[model samples]
Target: MSARLEVADIFRRHGEAYRQAHHGHLGRVERRVMSAIELCRTAALGGHIEECRACGAVRVAYNSCRNRHCPKCQTAVARDWLAARASELLPVPYFHVVFTLPAEIAAVAFQNKAVVYTILFRTAAETLRTIAADPRHLGAEIGLIAVLHSWGQTLTYHPHLHCIVPGGGPSPDGSRWISCRPGFFLAVRVLSRLFRRLFLEALRVAFEAGGLQFFGSIADLAGPAAFARLLAAARRRDWVVYAKPPFGGPEQVLAYLGRYTHRVAIANSRLVSLADGKVTFRWRDYRHGRKTKLMTLKADEFIRRFLLHTLPDGFHRIRHYGFLANGRRVARLASCRQLLAVRAPETAFRAEPVTDLPSLTHPCPCCGSPMITLAVWHHGQAPPPRSAWNDSS
Candidate 1:
């Protein structure tokens, strides 16, 4: 709740030593993440003075690190993303579907993050579109908003995709709308079976084509025999594909997006304390009735777990598919609104800035007066340039 219990506090106090100890093992991008978290919203990044127009109150506004991994800055990112998505909401019901990789696949994903993660997205989208159009299922072309989450409740490496789909879709012939049964979508068991088959088949193709990498503990899997064994074991197991009931309406879907989009591994609110070289934080023990518990780890270990979710540079965690595909979204959305007989936001209302917008950017903390920017504060160095996070070698 306070600065003492925030992630920045822990990083500021212990990050330098942790970086020094892990110098040889950590990548340049990982080190940059540590540096950004350590200096987030602090005097080190510089600050600007703002003066209240009515009361003459002066306030110093510190610059945010704006790193995607920084806990303090992701809130704004989530807000902006959700705001953009608000108008894209359809009048029909929405469903939440999840696609998860098994531990064996997750191990390979750890080494080949960009490749494996991209494969995961592609496989998931293909499975959904393929099954939903089989004539036995919905038989409509569904739209989905998929988000990639790589961490479990305790910050463990568990790669999964969270997909928000419409309950129905446009007909295959694009002649008319097709809607699923009320409060029901595709069957989860069928989805899981198809998803497992498609992903394993694609993984086999990537392996035979020399697209995947292996190293350290998994070096043996690079061989054809070892890789076949891996695939066989994965095939025998049931891949998890969880589907929840449809959301009540568009408002509920927007509320759900606020939580997952652009989220970091851990939030500042969960941190309880950092003392005696151990950082204590609240975590959910999902296996045990979802019990609330406290977990403490050494300073170095804490930082290590936190950095495990840092994505490869330019790797998009959130992806769109089917009707929501990025290239076709604008035209498809406009067509969908017309077909569904719903009005777009701009067409429904006049375009004027909301009255409450100013409170977000320029408001006096002391007096409720409008605060104006006094001067711009420039940092000593520019933010780190985007580069590849790891080398294949």
Candidate 2:
């Protein structure tokens, strides 16, 4: 019955002040994010009108910026994406794996977002596929849908990939389904080591190809020696690769994807208050068993923290690999389903009504007759202004 204090509210209240404080220092990404948040769901972008004919109800629907990083827009998009993906899930146990980069690599990823993030996906996928295909492991080509998350609860740059992989896969020989032992999936220790090596190797390749950029505090890392030292440090430390126990069934995987796939740094419901120029919100400390606690941050500081996750333009955070690889996904996935003895799903999930809009027809202003479209107006340019009669006439 009460209003929720959201990150948007904080941005609405103090985003300008924050911008002023960081003026001449804000990166392109952060500046664009500020503009998006302040103008989203406002009249600046124009809108559509929906009128209920039966009930005399009218609603003005504002346009969304449709920025993937915007919290308000991500939910509906996430839901639609989940619905499409739901049918691809096999009717078997699914495992959740997380591949995390060390803080050192996270620093590099912050600097070279598109390149490093792509490397993260490729390396993690390669590690999983290679390890899964080995005779010592499942010896089957597996499928995984990976989603990249760049922020932790407090909105710091913590790059990690979350993957949902089916517990079993078609055997390499194509004779049968290969199932792993119950309660165990891929070996995390092996995954961590392979992930480290592959990611570092890929990073070296990216650097050589001039696909990386360094700035600000990360400028020193542009040198090979410094980059090598960073890699060595990552290898010396334990890379975190965690595997959650098998999910119950296929439907559960749909629910899981709905939450994780398109999540932003924070959600609207988490905030409790915004008063006295301070924002208070609840966050779960995952390292401490999901303990919930309230944290208060100055309004400007809150926006600063929230802006830390503004991704590079057109950067794709989610990726598919192995059997789900782009080019061969259809064929490979069909073979997998046949071998697993599971038929493809009969119907896909639908989160909304498919027929929400009326067919296009111009209602005549004079007689209320429906006017069929004879031609389309191209480029939306107005017709040339008509010329008045000649002066001689």
Candidate 3:
């Protein structure tokens, strides 16, 4: 049912030694991630037992860790989340925009994730709002959904914001919905300049207010002179901001983000091999037209690179801003519907009772009858003697 190497195999084989070697250095959250991946889908996490009706067959389904960083757990989670937002889709063109951190700033962010990443989110949102509201542009309040990604194809610490935006927005007075030109959203050059200014200014505030810290090579930045120099260097660098062609419909936006929102540093399908304490995987080198290439790294080194992307616990990686803000989303969306001359979604699509929904369980393999759950298995339980049953965590 599966092909290619997986990250789970790597963890199951080498996790204990890696944990012991870095015992004192690993953070609590990192430790939790390791445990979750190692125990995922194994008897260590237990299983669900279902018996067939006519054929008298039995099925055992193991529990998943459901950790945010687990590759195997994201598909179902993404589907459920996207379904919830399906009714919110306005029949408007959508755009995809990316705001990235400059290399010098990225170096600092590599150390201070919580503080710097928060600033990245706030400033990117502010830049979009400011530019879209200018008379030279659309001159309306815009709304966007942004997801944070901290790694690049090569698994380097490259932090960037991926934003799915409507081509236009509601007027400041909320009287009408504004639409941008057919093929253009906003100029990437303009977005880049504005985003750089706002982000650097915010970074300066964070630095002066003692909200940031310097470590290792950047430790000299603890002094005011060094910090100023670093800021000046980052200012001279060109920050990257780009927008893709407008999407045909709102569902396009949902489909695009469903693939992005829940991914980790890498997926198991990309893994090629693990042998001689070295791991090989596939990656895309964007500098060369995104050609696929294989990369090899020591097992410990690969683990280190993976851990670099772990976010501060409880941080919400996906965010909504402007017209889409939760406080007024319903009213704002209602106004958009009126302006666009689209009727409200039918009751079947909105606020339908859960009990009326179709069942999610699997059917009997032979008889097509809905299988009944026989027992709930908990981790660490001593199994009662039974034939044809083996503990599969």
Best by TM-score: 3
Each model's lDDT comes to: 0.84, 0.78, 0.83
Instruction: Pull out the clashing pairs in model 1.
Output: none
lDDT of 1 by residue, 8-76 (tens): 787888888988898888988898888888888776797666667678776667789999999889877
Best by lDDT: 1
Task: Name the better of 1 and 3 by lDDT.
Answer: 1
The whole-model C-alpha lDDT of candidate 3 against the native structure comes to 0.83
Clashing pairs in 2: none
* Alpha carbon RMSD to native, model 3: 3.6
TM for every model, in the order presented, reads 0.91, 0.87, 0.91
User: After superposition on all CA atoms, how large is the RMSD of candidate 2?
Assistant: 6.8
Model 2, position 243: C-alpha lDDT score: 100
Between candidates 2 and 3, the one scoring higher on TM-score is: 3
Residue by residue across 200-279, what tens digits does model 3's lDDT show? Answer: 89989998999998878889988999888987887788889989888877657776877799889999889989999999
TM-score of 2: 0.87
Residue-wise C-alpha lDDT for candidate 2, range 1-393, written one tens digit per residue = 877666667887888888888998788888887777766777565543333333433344456777776788887788778777876777768899999988878988887888888889889999999999997988988888999998888777798999989887877877888888897889999999999999988998888888888888889888989878877887799899999999887777888888899888889888889999998888889989999989998888888778777778887788887777778887887888888777888646776745533332334444554333222212222322214211120
Q: Which pairs clash in model 3?
A: 41-393, 42-393, 43-393
